[model samples]
Target: MSQADKLRQLLAQDKLHVMPCCFDALSAKLIEQAGFDLTFMSGFATSASRIGAPDLGLMSYGEVLDQARNIVEGTSIPLIADGDTGYGNAMNVKRTVAGFAKAGAACVMIEDQLAPKRCGHTPGKAVVSRDEAFDRIRAAVDAREEGADILIMARTDARHDHGLGEAIERAARFKELGADILFVEAPKTREEMIQICRELPGPKMANIVEGGETPELSHQELHNIGYAIAAYPLTLLAAAMKAMCDALAALKDDEPRTHLLSNFGELREKIGFETYYAASERYSTSRRY
Candidate 1:
């Protein structure tokens, strides 16, 4: 099955999918090895990992597509990529969706945020007018109809600037425009989250950023609240960063930091070294003509 078909089947099942977002090829592989059915290439985490910068629209469309391609190549599971602000106007939205689809993304998220959009939970975030927002989704749907073979996830961040009602209304129209998924970013309370699900129809995604605006509900809780997917955008990144910092601190203290290390054999296996050597052994005496 196609990645998009796999994702659709997963969503069709009556359960909430727990998606741990990825920032790079290695991270994507780790998540897949850990048995996640799907993953998202978080712009915030990707920006930090790739460029050592914040996700305030600093990474261009080409850079984001390259990252998406790397992550998609590293795993067999479906990937949903963040296509921030579509990187330009309505036509640009189509191009971004097509690029992500060609890169093997199961879905590409296009938000209604203004040009040079910032992180959803960050300050200074603003969305464009209603017409422009709808136009973006329309273009994305058009791209999909034109053989992109990817899902369109329409996101709205107007809750922070306007209100929950505005965000819901925008997402509703996006759904009408043929968005396969709807993301109302940064809903601050459980009540608000519940209300969003109650109001919107079809598959919906909840972005759970650690220490951010949304409530950190359990998978069951989110499922009960009617979310199709619960995405933890920064959990892996945060955990990895903390471990590296601690390992470095122990190194400074002249300690081996064995507790901070994975078993060498397991690491080698996870990195495919063992598999590579085994495959090489079969060709050890072979000479190509």
Candidate 2:
């Protein structure tokens, strides 16, 4: 079966899937090596990794697609890409879904935030009209009908601008509109999390942003609350950033903590050096140019 089909089957089973966000191919491979069945291609991590910018809708669809392609190539695990606001309107949503599916995404998440969307945990966020949000999801569902098995995860950031009730209502509507999964982003309390799962129908996903507004729950807790998937979108990025900063600071202090970093051979091995070497040996006889 295809990776998308595999992901669908996995979601169908009675268990919670924890997907850590990966910004690039190496991280994706590491996630697979860590024995995860799936990984999320986060826009926040991608924007930060690619251009050192925040996730304020700075990265374009093409850039995210490139990153998704690289991650798909690097790992066999299913990837769910973050397609922020579908990169435009309903037509854009359709195109975004098709493009991500073509680029090997097992699923794509489209949010309801307005243009130049901010992070879900950030303030000053605004969502489009309810009709517009429905249209975007409908477009994505239609796109999926055109021979792409990619799942559509409809996300609502209405909880910040609107209230929890509104967020729950929007999630219900999104589920009715054919979203394979519902993500009500940034629920503040544990009660709200339970309420969301109890109220919303079908498969549900939860976002666990460290130090964010949402409460960080364990996988079992999330499963008990009826969440099929829980995504830690910035955990890897945050860890990587802190490690690099500390490494730089140590280098400036003349401490040069080389042991803290991966060796060159190990890095090469992580990036599939052995696979390339085997391919070269199988296809060629000599190394002379």
Candidate 3:
């Protein structure tokens, strides 16, 4: 089955699907090896990894697509990618959806934030007009109908700028526009999270960002609140960052931080070094010419 179909099947199951955010192919492989059935190519993480920049709409469509392609190639799990603001207007959203789907994304999340969009948890984020936001989602739905089975996840940042009511309304409209999933980003309180799942129609996704504006709820807690999918967008990134920092500090003191790192051999195996060598050996000896 196609990756998109696999994701759809997973969503159809009567349980919450947990997707950890992977910033690159290595991270993607790690997520898969760690037993996750699905992964998310986080825009915020990608910007940080690729350009060492914040998620202030700095990464372009091409950049994100390339990263998505790398992650998709590195793992067998279905991947959901963050398509921030679809990178432009409605037409741009169509192209963005097509590009990401072609790059092997099972689902693409397009938010309603305006141009130069900031991270959902960041302050000073503004959303487009209701009509424009709806147009973007309609465009994404149209793109999906044009032969891409990629699921369309509609995200609304209106919760921070406007209010929970507005965010819920936007998510409802997005659902009407054929969004496969709804994401109301940055709901500060548990009550707001519950209300979002209760009020929003169809399948819902919750983004749990550590230390962000939204409360970090466990998978079971979110599932009980009616969330279909829960994404920990920066979990790996945050952990990796701290590990790298401490390792660097230890290195400066001439103290090998062996305990702070994964075994090199195991890390190579996790990244498919053994499989690669075996494939090379098989192909090298089986050549007919």
Best by lDDT: 1
Write candidate 2's Cα lDDT for 1-289 as tens digits.
7778988998998899998999999888999988998999888888989988999999888998999999998899999998999988899999999999999999999999999999888878999999999999999999999877799999999999789999999989988888999999999999999999999998999999999999999899999999999999999999999999999999999996987899999888888877778677755664323
Kindly state the number of residue pairs that clash in model 1. Answer: 0
User: Could you tell which candidate, 2 or 3, scores higher by lDDT?
Assistant: 2
Clash number for each model: 0, 0, 0
Model 1 gets an lDDT of 0.94
Tens-digit per-residue lDDT, 1-289, candidate 3: 9899999999999899898999999999898888888998887888999999999988888988999999998888999998999987899999999998899999999989988989877777999999999999999999999987799999999987689999999999999889999999999999999999888888898889989888888888988999988899899999999999999999999997999988999878887877877767768675433
Q: Please give the range of 10 consecutive residues that has the lowest summed lDDT in model 2.
A: 280-289
User: Candidate 1: which pairs clash?
Assistant: none
> For every candidate structure, what is the RMSD over all alpha carbons to the true structure, in angstroms?
2.0, 1.6, 2.1
Query: After superposition, which runs of candidate 3 have C-alpha atoms over 4 Å from their true positions?
Result: 285-289
Candidate 1: residue 73 lDDT (0-100): 88
lDDT per prediction?
0.94, 0.91, 0.90
TM-score of each: 0.97, 0.96, 0.96
Candidate 1, TM-score vs. the true structure? 0.97
lDDT of 1 by residue, 1-289 (tens): 8888999999899899999999999999999999989999999999999999999989989999999999998899999999988999999999999999999999999999998899998999998999999999999999999999999999999999899999999999999999999999999999999999999999999999989999999999999999999999999999999999999999999988999989899898898776667777768564222
